[model samples]
Target: MLELDASAHPGGIALWGAVLAVYDTSSMPPEIGIHVHARSTREGDKQVDDTFDTVVVKLSPDEQATITGDTAINFYLSRFLNRDIKLLRCPHCDEAHLDAGYFAVRPHRRHMCQACGRQFNDSEKSISNPVSLLKRVHYDVPPVRAPRNLDVKQTSYPGGMQIWASNPALVWTSARAEEAGLHIHLYDSQGNIVVDDTFDHVEVDGIELNEVHVQYFMAQQALPHLSEKIVSLTCPRCDRPHFDTGDSAFFPHVEHTCEHCNEKFVSKGRRKLVVSNPFEAVRKSLRANWQSHRI
Candidate 1:
């Protein structure tokens, strides 16, 4: 059999080679090591990873090494099966069994095979090869987001469903609650918090809410209200927004202390109005129509 280090081979389908030698597993080999496997699969590249579904295997190198060209000789065979095999054919079934040795029973052959259920042969023959993986060693494996969603707030809790970790907990919580119902939170692209009543209890006792699109024709129904106010006082030093709504919306020189930066600054009494409650007022409103099709 041919053996090479080159990556492109017809035998590339094999992640594990066939067993070469079967030794008494009374001990283990020392050179064997493991690799923890994980992959990031989606960010434009993989935007996400699955840590929970990871496997425990001999760790493949994080960076794959480039393999090219071929080695000169067959350093190994398939299953790394080289010239060092020690097996004999069972006369009755033509099956291969580990040859014990010539000296064990010099005058006669005495062997029993479990595989083919062949009776022991009382004839004389030669016995030869032996296999051992006794020094088998395995090293220990040393172990080692998101939000484009609009600021959908839990305006009413106990009213909305909190996802339970298990089926029993979900059933129990559904039964003994002060408030139990279906709840939906809508977040639009370009940052808008949707506030609408339809996002509330559809079944009043439902555990599932149909995910509604934040865009399209039916989006008008799921769209949040666009009439809400946002008040803020930001520090020029720290860029921390403050919520101090004591004076009117038109105070000229509002004294402010930034909790983040611990610096003080003065600015106008600020009360900016953001279109909330399923806000869809966009400069690209026509684009949402002309660029995309009706749903």
Candidate 2:
């Protein structure tokens, strides 16, 4: 449950953190299981090959899970691709489990697995099946690390969030988050609301979301307090918290449009991120090979 050392970069902590890597190292191909070396058999002195026996061993627990674990499969968020945490496999040894050390200081296709010291293109085979890549989408709340500064005592709790190795990707497509949608408010001592807001659907990088994405949005924006709301913008004037839904949450602030209002701005000098409130505009549907997981 421990986090990376205090010296770990903020970006490193986000990409790696308590991330547990479960490698799909099973070499058994689908339907065509692992094959043993072919042996020669003779028949009637004609050197004719005898029939081969097919073995269908009972699947291991892990293997059985693979068949029904579609909702539990591992996938990376492209929102995190600037660091390219998306693909950490090895070409020399087709290893799926690797670390951020394998990546360059910045975004690049080059990588060398620390396990095998072998080179690979982060772009090459980054995705095994491109066509089947686009699968079900879900929201995730990444593990949160605590701040070490003295100011932290006054601002937040001591313990931080965690995504244990046992199930780093358990929250990949959380049913709880999906069902909860997004709720922003505070109650008084008497259970009266201070400020109330609800979003049945929120949008991130053009991805329509609900309660499903609140945790993820908070993590991306680094909102220290859970009470901190995801948005401050509302509509009618087209003036809302300006965000680039077209822009990435991982590497956001490229587009000058509001995520909720979709209002485009021409200001050369503007804040990195404006106030709360998503741009509420209709955009053409955009689907990508996206998936969700816990860590």
Model 1 residue runs over 4 Å out of place are 1-175, 178-229, 244-253, 269-295
Alpha-carbon runs more than 4 Å astray in model 2: 1-89, 99-109, 116-118, 122-237, 259-263, 266-295
Q: Candidate 1 local accuracy as lDDT?
A: 0.25
Clashes per model (N, Cα, C within 3 A): 22, 16
Cα lDDT over the full model 2: 0.28
Which candidate has the highest TM-score of all?
2
State how far residue 59 of model 1 sits from its true place (Å).
64
Worst 10 residues of 1 by lDDT: 164-173
Q: Report how far off residue 232 is in candidate 1 (Å).
A: 3.0
lDDT of 2 by residue, 141-192 (tens): 4433221111111012111111111212211222222222243233333444
lDDT scores of the candidates, listed in order = 0.25, 0.28
TM-score of each candidate structure, all chains considered together: 0.17, 0.32
**Candidate 1 residues 183-276, lDDT tens each?**
2332234223343222222321212222221111111111123112322345677665443322221122345555577786655434333211
